[model samples]
Target chain A: MLYFTAMSDDNTLYEDLLRIRRFEEAVLDNFPKGVFFGTTHTYLGQEANAVGVLDDIHSGDIVFSNHRGHGHFLAYGGDIRSLFAELMGKTTGVCGGRGGSQHLQWQNFYSNGVQGGIIPIATGMALAEKRKYSDAIVIAFMGDGTLGEGVVYEALNMASLWQAPILFVLENNRIAQTTPIEMAVAGDISARFKAFNIMVRELDSSDVKEILPVAAELIAEVRSLKSPRTLILNTYRFGPHSKGDDIRDKHEIDQLRVERDPILIHAHRLDSNHKEAIELKVEKYIQEAFNQALADPLPDASKALTGSINHQ
Target chain B: MPTVLYALNAALQNALASDERVVIMGEDILDPYGGAFKVTRGLSDSFPDRVITTPISEAGIVGIAAGMALRGLLPVVEIMFGDFITLIADQVINHAAKFRWMYNDQVRVPIVIRTPMGGRRGYGPTHSQTMEKFFIGVPGLRVLAPNTFSDPGDLLSKAIFEDNDPVLFIENKLLYLNTIHDSNRLSEFEFFEQTPEPNFYHHSKHNGTIADLSNNYAPTCMLSLRDAPPPVLTIAAYGYISEFAYQAALNLAYEYEVFTELVYPTQLSPCDMGAILSSTKRTGRLLVVEEGTHNLGWGAEVIAQTAENLGSRLLSARRIAALNLPIPASGPLEEAVLPGIEHIIQAAQKMV
Candidate 1:
């Protein structure tokens, strides 16, 4: 069932995970020093879920993500330099500094700050693909927190009813902002999707070996049947929800960081030399991206009105 | 022969037949149900694959339509009622209306949201309301309301096929049964020809004393009685209220010798201020009417723009709108609050 079993393939996946982790670590390192004005939700522990799910996505396929989306964007080949510039609010940013951390639209990838707003939009995109008779499927990524929003249920109903070619990926990190999943959501999450007759798959996100094959299967089934499917990745976030908001017990986080670290788990499967080489390359690339982004100037105030409204 | 509803149906039919990418999505819009208003009657049957029957999720419908537009499909979404628009405001205002600008003009959301608005049918507080004023201030949204002269079919076609921006096409429940007055009583299914330009002085007096600058195409329309002296008052209105304003103008000309000029603008968002300002300068006195609540209504914008443009040339500018109260379900209470011909005439008489 495993789609990628080679040592080289594992190294590639390990490298992808490291890139997202290192890039976000760089962001966190700079944010507290006033190098970046606004806040960002770091994707520290959930890197494997993004890389695993995105590896199955084609160039033509579209992906939409929620607030904790830096990992998803990066896994889908988002430029590190543009992302750094965006975080710095530079004119060279993907959205021309209009969308800083939470809002980014690059090529076929889109992310929004709202928890469940993008679900219906991604469902609609899947519907469009179905209507066009194209095999392209859409992936909508949200956390366990998004289950609280009514629009997610509405989107699920429509996606199933229309048999839209979409894969709904829920990264259930067990915590929403500061609230635990059990505190905010009720009953079984997979059962909720099953009520709408959607096929569901559950995977432990810490294990990339399992996540990649399962995500690949679900994505293929979605494209082949032109129907909606759900992949629930049981993941965890190592960092606080955002900068300066550590509500969880530090002891528990530290324990999880040691026991369920996705990077550490994936690194064990790779050769030591290969892992070291990838780490060094990712470190150098992230450093260069940060330097370039830091050198870029902030957008001019006079051009503020340029992108406020479309002229044509 | 062609009512506004039928004209709209013809326009949709044309759009579906012409463009393979044009799709219609709404609740109960499939064949047999057609739509709540039957504006989409026989459309689903004609193009079964293109017409979509969505669940009663306004937010989902609009959000999906924006996605469809982003992926290179022209989606025409119908929200059964205007009051329900509040549910989808986040998607429309935050996503659809801002996608083009927020994405740095990399994408165009060529989507049209069609919904019926206004009071008259006693559908009650929730159903009977004119909320188009809420969307007029949204920068990227084009709000269009077709009156008797401004062909709904032509404008709907323009929004679906011609324009590349997101449009809020507001249809009045009362106006659905009415046809274009100058359409030569064409068949209900026949598509009326769109006029060349939006601004035309259809009837101009030889002495230039009475000019009827009413173009069938443009959002703004100016109507006056035949061979009347210069208008003492200019009455401006749009949507269903424009019918009342026209009637009041006729009464002012015949009964009171007020010689009133009526201006109806179909485009509400980027309002036709030039046409309104020119009429205000000639008449000096301006009276605006609307069916929406008086506070911050479309009439307020019209009066503000006219005053800003004409300044001292405007002798007196006033607005007559529905009382600032929630539309009640009771018939008498609804009539009590809504602006009518009597209110328009009385306001004009006072202004003049």
Candidate 2:
């Protein structure tokens, strides 16, 4: 029951998960040597949320992500080398080095460093697609930490009233940069969306198999109903908030890694030899991306002076 | 004569009819009510789906508009009042303005935010304000204000269709009722198109030839009393106050014999300083009049730019702007604090 016979190939999903894992591992492992610019939020334990939800993405659909977005970007099929180059502030980067870490844009996938800001934008994009009769739904990802922003509620209200085709994904990592969700969030998170008459679906899982089917159903409902839906994924983050800022107990993190590791949970379903093959391929792929990004030239400093807005 | 409100409404109608990508979103902009200033009157009835009436969330509205613009839609958002723009500053400054540059030209936010600014009504402190100064220097954003000289509709069309950046289109609250002037209406003053060509002013100075109207979207206009003596002072102004500055110029020539020329540029940021500089060089003295507060305002910037360009050639310079104080609800207090035609005249006399 965990795996869907009609769904994506399990090997491909496992490889996708491994790619994010190895890419983030490369980021963390290379951070000490100062190979990257700006801070990064690694998706060590929360890889399943991205790989599972984005499995439902159709062409012309929009995906809006937050600061902790590398996993989501990789799952959305963003170029690994370009993402690496972007983090290194090189010319071959996704945003040509202007948007270092946290800010990335490739095709219909966009990410901003600001929390809760992308929600309204996503709602608007969904509405735009609906107006065009394109039948393209939007998937906007936010964190439990972003619940503190009042604009999220405003966007939810508008989205419900307008019947915008969007799936609101709340990745509840139980922590917001050292602050626990219980301390920061008030009342019930699901009720917040329900208050605006938006359909709510909650899940607590680290396995991509479990998340994939539920996310697919919710995404289908959003597309068919042409209305907003909230999918609150209660998850765990096994890495530092951003480059060695962890304040949680090491023993608790180690215990969570063993019990709630998404990669480990999914690896049990795959053959050992196949898992090793994916690990090796992802390792080589991530290493080549990192090395090529490191070797790429930095963006031309002179072009930074020219105004992006029309100066003529 | 068409009113400024008519021009703006026509612009909206023309944009919606011309392109399906154009959308208008605001609070209470629907039928029967139109907008607060009626600048969006008759738009919703004409294009129901395009003119959207939303909740009272300025930040959310602007944020949504930015999204729509990013996805190949030209969204023209209307903030109920210019004062309410403070609530959406984060969305406009951080998101709309920074998207193009921050994204490294991956996308463009072609949104036109139309809001009524300025005070003459008794709408109190928060309702009436010339707050366009705050958004002037923001990169990847353009600030445009239309006056009586040319068609404001033309400029709005250009902003919505031509420009690939976000434009804050300011419509003065008092100017909504004022009449737009054509060549016949401006017969008392000499009107000439400030051509975009280089050294046109220098050529005009040598030959004394008047240039015909050039088809420019937001060209600056220069005006002086017909057959008057050479200008001794140059006055710079924009938006609703530019009309008063023109009147002050005529008053100075006929009534006081000060002989001043008025330079009004519709585009504020990335301000076209060519006409202002040429007039200042001829006049030797410059005076800037604005309705915004005096500190770090539009007048200060115009003065600063003129001084930077004509350091030694500038004989004298002065800025006439509103007093640095919160606009009071009382009529007399508001009038006393805001810069008026008398202020421009007095400032011109002193500079000359």
Candidate 3:
């Protein structure tokens, strides 16, 4: 268990959280209307994980994301219109729309590819950072499915051995696609990293107040210690794994939704004025973001063959 | 004639003198003993800092080279044997070759890996195996296999200076004693080596080409330059198998009507298809051979591709090659499994 110190915000944190919520809602609305193809795993229930982690990381700090990566990229100030364009394979998109729906990239920081494969690369980047003496932290975002890959262990071993300044954020959504936590995970998740002797923090990912401060402390500890750290953020999907697998059955989705609604819980914790203000601000931002993405031109003809934003 | 050891020593000496940026990294490339094979003899004494002995981790050596190349250093990493190179395959393929493309042309990995590949001195499966095919599959890699002694110097210099990619220069153990001369046959590598501080090395006119065997261009004729070659059909080969192929070619030419044109491919990966094509086209018949098992062996691939393209020209193109078995520790067994001179003679007789 971890605790968050009492601190005040300029309402920007609340606004950021609202922005994520509204953006997903807009995506859900537009997706079914044939404007978007493929699946999108919305982070409607896992807003705190994004806000909590991204707040501690600087602009120069690199982050690795997974299939459920829109919120992660968005949290790190990724250009919304460019990202949207990239998903649509438009020249205006971030990766020149080369990395469609599943793949996403922004500059040197890449959150494109399967979860586990990129973990070792993040370790390599951390190695490069240490060698170049750059003050860059590598954050590898993964889901429960990624834990099974041998790469995770290999990267973790190297990172811990090197005392690399890397943070492994495992968003334990209690389900990997349709598989439940019990069916998927064999050993205790925290115990898995204990052999590597890395610092671990298991906490309710719903509470931004709880998650933000601990992340700051852990990140600081890693920087100061020049060591790697892991934090198992127990989050929920709120929606299905993606748009294609929406798990639309009310009885099934509602049961999972009720107990694991991070945003609703956060709202319940805050005042009515705060919640309404956040919702209103977030709705406005989402509207603006959607309009901006919509107005952005489709990718130029040459960009169709381009496969990735980073490559282009 | 100067041996492969002499050529290697001269190659390193000249390369180091020409390029200040070129540095040699390996287990023992220094003065106390230049190397097990003495390829870098007297290198450490001449260029002390340039020849560095690394910890016994092939991966570390190559990885550091990759890093150094990124920092604008042309590092020549000697893995000693091709077998040990697999340990550093990740560093070589993933980091060095792909970094430039993956980083969108922001970085470059200019490094060269030199090692003696195949085996004949009873090193067995682990030490003797040839796996150039594994790496040939990888993109963004430039491989140079020097069949004769002379090209090692030239190809190595080019590999060191060439920017934006890594080069794999594989040397055959048998070719260490083999000799070559300049294109005009005026200056020999052996004589060039004997002469102190000689920079210009002549390319062998024969160039492992069968066409040159019968050509009126006596300057480029196989007989002009007296280098160590099998008597009958100097079957050009690379790695440790060169000795077998050369000897076998000679045996076949004497025992049978088939005249063997031994053309050793110095560069295996990014194979000099033109040179190979010319050799096969002239010879009309070839007995491709290697120490590696024949199921998709490097030599068989060359034979297959040649036979496919030059269907009409090919004269019984077959590989008197090794079977699908690891190199046995027993000397006789190893020889039995390996295609020998007798096998070469039989294949050549059938072809003729």
Write model 3 residue lDDT over B235-334, tens digit each, in one string. Answer: 4355556556556655554455445665556555544344456656766665666655677756766776777778988766676667678777788988
Across A11-104, the per-residue lDDT of candidate 3 in tens digits comes to 6667667667777777888886666556677888888898888776765677867778888878788776666655555656665554555566
Clashes of 2: 0
lDDT tens digits, residue span B1-352, model 1: 5788889999999999988889999999988989999999999999998999988999989988888888878899999999999988888887888777666666677789999998878899899989988888887888889888667798898777656678899998999998676734422212122233633344322232312212333346667665768788878888888778877877887799888777777877766566677778888988988899999878788888878888888899888989999898899999998988999888778877
Worst 10 residues of 3 chain A by lDDT: A303-312
Say which candidate scores most in DockQ. Answer: 2
The residue-by-residue lDDT of candidate 2 on B1-352, one tens digit each, is: 8988888889899889988989999999998899887888899899998999999988898888888888878899999999999988878887888888788887877788989999989888898788998988887778889888877888888778766678899988888888888966788788876636532222121132321112124778898888888889999888999888988887888788999888989988766688899999999999988889999988788888889999999999998888998888999999998999998888888777
Give each model's clash number: 0, 0, 18
Off by over 4 Å in 1: A1-8, A307-312, B183-218
Q: DockQ, in order, for the candidates?
A: 0.34, 0.45, 0.07
Tens digits of per-residue lDDT, candidate 2, A1-312, equal 232334578888899998999899889998989889989998999999999999867878899999999999999999899999999999999999988888888899999988888888888888888888887899999999999998888789899989999999999999999999889998999999999999899999999998998988888888878999999999999999999899999999999999999898888888999989988888888889889999999977777646434452
Candidate 2 lands at a TM-score of 0.95
Q: Judge candidate 3 against the unseen true structure and give its global Cα lDDT, from 0 to 1.
A: 0.65
Against the true structure, what is each candidate's TM-score? Answer: 0.92, 0.95, 0.68
Off by over 4 Å in 2: A1-6, B195-216
Task: Pick out the ten consecutive residues of candidate 2 chain A with the lowest summed lDDT.
Answer: A1-10
Report the poorest 10 consecutive residues by lDDT, candidate 3 chain B: B211-220
